[model samples]
Target chain A: MADAAISVQGARKVYSTPGKPKRTAVSNVSIQVESGTIHGLLGPNGAGKTTTLKMLLGLVRPTGGTFEVLGMDSTRPSGRRRVGFLPEQPYFPVNLTARQAMRFYGSLGGVDAARIPERTTALLARVGLADAERTELSKFSRGMLQRLGIAQALLGDPEVVILDEPASGLDPVGQRDVRNLMLELRDRGVTVLLSSHQLSEVEAVCDQVTILNRGSVAAEGDINALLNVDGRTSVRAMNMAELPPQVVSVAEEIAVSGGMWVFSMPTEQTRAVVDAIDEAGGTIAAITPKRESLDDYFAALLAAHTEDVAS
Target chain B: MMKRIWPIATAVMMDSLRRKVVYVVLGFAALLVLAIPSLPDYGLGVESAVFREVALALSYVTGLVVVLSLAANRVPAELEKRTVYNVLAKGVSRWEYLVGTWLGILGVMAGAIVAFTAIEMVVGYFTYGELMWRLWEGALATWFEMGVVSAFAVAVSSVTGPVVVVTAALAALFIGHSRSTLLGGEGAMALRPFYPSLDAFNVVNPVAHGSGVPLVYMLSMVVVFVGFAGACLSVGVLLLSRRDL
Candidate 1:
């Protein structure tokens, strides 16, 4: 099998709105996800995250470009067979029990009938629905429904799992459980592609992240490398009058509030600012380095894209 | 493809069977079929003629019920509930899904039709002291007619709302039944000069000629209507596959 679970190049999707020119949902967007990694497709609303996922799953045809999944063309049935998907809001037959729904989806995946019962039980237990296995899905809470959606997506042990906003409408505890389950799936060597507006969840779970804006990729790389908040440190002093001019110049922004100097510094000049403060005989009350989160990184990317579009 | 289609169709059948609507429709059909023996007392016609007339009317009513309850709701209900996305993403081809669903609902309607026909036959035998071949023939024609009408209902439900699809299908049924009479009229035939043009309209009408229930003609009409239904359904699947959902 290929090392990349999903690979897209120059993918584009255009929907022709009546009485208007065609609108592009994804434009020349390319993405590559390695096997056994949890990749996050992060973007603001209407940024084409769902469109990209739909194209990858062959749910919608692309206007341009090529993509492959699990060593087969994405448009082919063989490639789709290796994929398990959780739609943003999945529905089950109202009268069907959790067990029955799982069995139905599992059977569609061609799982052996003899093994379905065992697999269904295991999946229900995994999603913390063991007690409600026989309960009708219509009676399930929103959180329980989301968990069941995960359980169904895991049926037949698919090679790649795509979850679109898996944690949306979930409570804090439900979100945490889903995040843990995603990590567990990753650990077990399953490639996962997840899309979410929850930056904290993406930050905590994703190994690689791709930020999109206006139907195009704004930034793509390892989460840690892209979101590194180096050279920025917070400082506290008894008085602001003693701060030096050279230190002030190097500080990207310095705000004095609650008797503390918050310095956003240039990446290469943090050491110089600290030394200058010491040489000037200013006593540093506290110095704490700040780390940029996925939220901040995405915000910066989106802001840059807006500026680019405006110009 | 067949492997994937069979399971989906099985699921559809199982789900439809669990709906209370199916039982209500079946019970009403059976009651109408059983009530035929009492209709001769109205003095509208001979006893056997009245029995056959009432039996045929009962079949049409029950068939309409079957088409409405079992067929019209297949796709619209799924789409409304948002469950269509789950099955569509399972790598099942659109055509397979449509065909499987149609067959599943068809099976349920067929079962109901057979049960109602059997009840009417038993009631006839007990009341009239002889088997009525014409009534049996009418029942067979009704089954075929129902199959064709239900297929059209399914096709309509694929693309339109439940209310519109059912109403349009019922309208089509009325037109199809009266088509021969309309076309045979002197003024109507005179207005359409082109033979081929007239023939085209004739093709859309499913009714055929015979006194004691046109069995062969009814069978052929059902087959042709099913072919039309298949074409409509294929178009529906194509539209659905390209839809944003």
Candidate 2:
């Protein structure tokens, strides 16, 4: 659609080295991320997720297909004027202080020289690096470097941002901060394409996800749609020390903790279970359609994909 | 264009300073230049000329070492460290990155050449009682030649690693300076124009033994620097554009 901020159509990449077999890093992978949304790129180690992102960002050459950001060819400098990227485990020249490094990147991002000082201050503060602004990068910790990478990617307030393993070396708090930052950017109408191995991080902020396996898109869609469990609903009840036998009869995946009973059942039997719980003097805390955790969904998706490839 | 290139160039220059290679080479060469007056085989009334020749040679080697140490590793190290991703991903063209890199190395070489020449001039003043201003011409020639060398290294490094880049760059230097000796045959004379040469930037003969390089020759070296550096960088940008980071 015209509204799609990033469109990768039939994207393919093949790496050729002398005296070795040609390796296909990405094949026929296409994804469309609409404006102002966070799209997660998911895959295993050799699944071409990073390669695809690299091709799109012009960091790697693509053997086939078209990649566009805001309808512009993102592989060119002019088209990338409004885009930003953070490489996996991003590194910078150790000789530069954090502020100077930001200035250098800000200039490359086409930010006004006069505005760089202010923008650098604000962005470093945003990423919690304000205190380390003048510290040379050689002295920065892994977590600090990752924060600086995020700060640099946000310079010039790019319309589109691509992040590869943005949380790779961060502690939990830093990862959370990055997630919050991505959400904040989305709220400001910035499009984000995040490539990450951290499934929980992806599940937390991604509106849509594209999973790759063996150099192709194995699955792609809204996060909820991909993980939703069909024909099932989850029920949570309170105040009853024990679940009534009638509710248990149809319930599956039942768990009791903190004096609350939680279970999933067939969607058709939701009414029967709710009625039974009501009769048993239990408070129906909530009832919602059940969805599988991303971890489980991803594992099964790959397992099924492996089977498909094998057979 | 300048906006992106200048920052990268400055960053390269700043980064180079922290690495001890430049100062170490410069210091060693300066000490050698200071000892140039003591060469015992100077001909009658040609002692200053000999000092100038040895000093000029020291300057050239010092410049090449500084240039090679920086250029040979700058691009490859950046690629290996993934530091270049930050710059290129910020919308700067690959050509800009290469040129900016060369500019930074050139900038450092210029600084080193001047500093080394200044030491030579001071030595010449104390030893022979004349400023020996001709060494500046030699320094300039070395600066331009090393600039071309750095460009070649940067271009080659776009597709390879530091070791290969250094090897290729040194080979280039050898070939660049050997066009006269290696292609002296009538059969090879036809290929002279096609072969890239570092001869234009070689003013050592006049700079070390005579009244120094002419103004016009000095201007032509700039032309040659532009032609050679531009060609090398164009090739580098082309190769880099196709590379996968």
Taking the tens digit of each residue's C-alpha lDDT, what string does model 2 give over A2-65? 3999999999998899999998888789999999999999999999988888888888888999
Q: Candidate 1 clashing pairs?
A: none
Candidate 2 residue-wise lDDT, B92-131, digit = tens: 8899999999999999888888888999999999998988
TM-scores for chain B, listed for all candidates: 0.80, 0.97
Residues forming the 10-long window of minimal summed lDDT in candidate 2 chain A: A50-59
TM-scores for all candidates: the values are 0.83, 0.97
True contacts kept of each: 0.48, 0.93
Which number leads on lDDT?
A: 2
RMSD of each: 5.5, 1.6
Model 1 / residue A231 / CA error / Å: 5.7
Docking class of 2: high
